[model samples]
Target: MWKIYLLAAISFLNGTSEYVIAGILDKIAEANHISVSSAGQLITVFSVAFGAGTPFLIAMFARMDRKKLLVYALTVFSVINILIAIITGYEMLMSARIISALSAGVMQVTVLTLAAVLAAPGKQGGAIATVIMGQSSALVAGVPIGRVVASHYDWNVIFIGIGAVGLLFSVLTLFAIPKTVAEKPVPLREQFKFFMRPRIAAYLLITFLWLGAYSVVFTYISPYFLDIFGMSNHGVTTALFIFGIASAIGAQLGGFSTDKWGAFRTLTGGMLLHAIALLLFPFIGQFAFLFYVLLIFWALAAWSSGSPIQFQLISLAPAAASIVLSLHSALGQLGMAGGAGIGGIAVKNGLLNYLPWIGAFTLAIAVGVTVLDKVYLNEKQFKETQSTLFIK
Candidate 1:
């Protein structure tokens, strides 16, 4: 359990950097004498690199001792944050962002894989939940703190503080986590076999689509509030804080429901909740308090999918769990990129309010994929499918 928390601490660091960028984008642009749109490229570089490079990097390093690789990743990740704080110029920041993305990408897969490895029997879902809460918690709490800090002090200070915290957490991880390795060294290319099966591929697509929907709205949430509800900085911060709390709590709900009911039900319920909330977004803000309430439920539904979806993938391909999850992380990041693009297009077309509809449409397809699997894929067939997804 403590190990799980340690992993969450690492996730907190990764997620804070990943998310806080949005909240502090203006400060970054101003200090560097770049356009906010150009500063936004920092996020573009990180997400694209994380999405496109994660699986290959994980597959490339599949043979390494999991524990040592994790430590190295943490060390690099922490150092990179500090470097970004000290490094001058947009080009340098862009380079550091990409490098950090790669390291964080590896850490994302390794921690989830290790969480499953370290969990007590029958408690893997809960363990995953504990680890995921770090990211979700960061999205809620850490980013606001960073936003506040950046507003009052220097943006560099935020990164410096994040780096210092990351270093402290890495030290704790070094002592707390035991050295471990995968069951055996899987051939690097053989990892792609995890995606060979149709059912498994469908699960991965669902991951992509679910995350896509979330990112579409989230990519512009601050602006959305400011524009639609005329929210001020403090108001946006309050809204994010509420959503953040809900998201953290939602991870636990997803884990509990996954363990108790099964991944299928948990995922369906989560998607349904998300779809409902998103569909109402266009009309809900007028209600003031109800809009914030919807935001909470939206966030809960948005994040609650985290554990069950990953748990489902691992369950579907336990032997190649690492590969499956690596791709899951990659595709999830891609979905964020894709969703952000979709949202950008919507905004460009004078249809910003319709972003939720687009998101809901993606969510609908995601839910359909699950139903497609459940109706067409059965117990015996699933076992046979799993067998096909491995390299013997």
Candidate 2:
């Protein structure tokens, strides 16, 4: 349990560095003298590097001690982020972000794998959620804190702060964490076999698109606040803070729901809830009180969607859990890349105000995928939403 907390702490640091930019895109853009869209490419590159690199890194570092590997990965992650803090020039920043992203992916996968392997029987879902809570907690702490820091200091200050926190956690991890018992390595060929399973592939496709949809709206949320609602930094921070709080609460709720209601039910319910929130965003965004109230439910639904989906995949192929999960993490990165790319193109065409609509449309595709799974992969599901939704 304590080991799980350590992993979560490291995750917090990494997640803050990865996600805080969303809240301060305009500040970063102004600081770099670049368009917000160009600054958004930072998300794409980071996602690309992490998504494409993790599996290879896993294979390459297959023999390393898990605990030492954790320390080393975080060290590199911290150092690269520090480089990002001190760097000037878009090219340099890009290089640092990619490097940090790759290291962060390795670190993330390692923690997730360890959590699954190390937890007590039937506690894998909770353990993973606790680990992931680090990232959700980052949402809670990072965005608003980063905004406050940037409002007084500069955008670069946020990176420096994140880098410093990463280092501190790296030290804490080294001392407090025990060496994770290593499992027999599964060969790449054997692991990739999970992809051939229809359920696995379909679930991955669903999450890939689901995350992309969320990113399209999330990536530009700050700029949207500025452009549409005429929000100040404090106002934008307030909205993001509520989102962070909801996301944290949602992560916990998602874990509990996955255990209680089953993954499929939790996932469908979460998606439907979030989609409803998206449908309402356009009507409520300008009225701060209404928007704030809506955002709580929206964020709750948004954050609740993740754990159940991951838990479902793990249940689908328990023997290859680590492999499926690694790919799961990778797909999230892929989704981020896709979302950032598509959103960038959309924003370029001046479609920023339509983000909520875009989210609803994309999430509908996820629901469609879910239905397809119900009809085609019905015998294959693991206490999925289908059983509960249909009153069976």
Best by lDDT: 2
Deviation in Å, model 1, residue 247 alpha carbon: 1.0
CA lDDT of each prediction against the hidden true structure = 0.82, 0.83
Per-residue error for 203 in candidate 1, Å, reads 0.8
- The digit string of per-residue lDDT tens for model 1 on 1-392 reads 88898898888888998988767765787899975456656776788899998777877787888888888888898899999999998899999999999999888778877898999999997887677778767888887888788777889998898778878877887788888886665664676776778778888899999998987777767667767778777777778778888888888788898999989999999999999999998887568888978988898888889888889888878877767877787888888878777776676567767888899999999999889888886565867768988744
**Candidate 2 accuracy as lDDT:** 0.83
List, residue by residue over 1-392, the lDDT tens digit for candidate 2. 88778777777777888898888888888988888888888988999899988778877888887888888988898888878878889988888889989898888878877787778899998898788878768789888888889888988778877778778878887887777755667777776777788888888887887788888889888998889888898898888888898888887798899999888788888888888888887777579788778889988888787888888888878877767877787888899888887888788888888877888788889988887887768665555577777895
Any runs in candidate 1 off by more than 4 Å, and if so which? Answer: 1-5, 26-41, 62-68, 86-91, 111-129, 170-183, 259-262, 348-351, 377-392
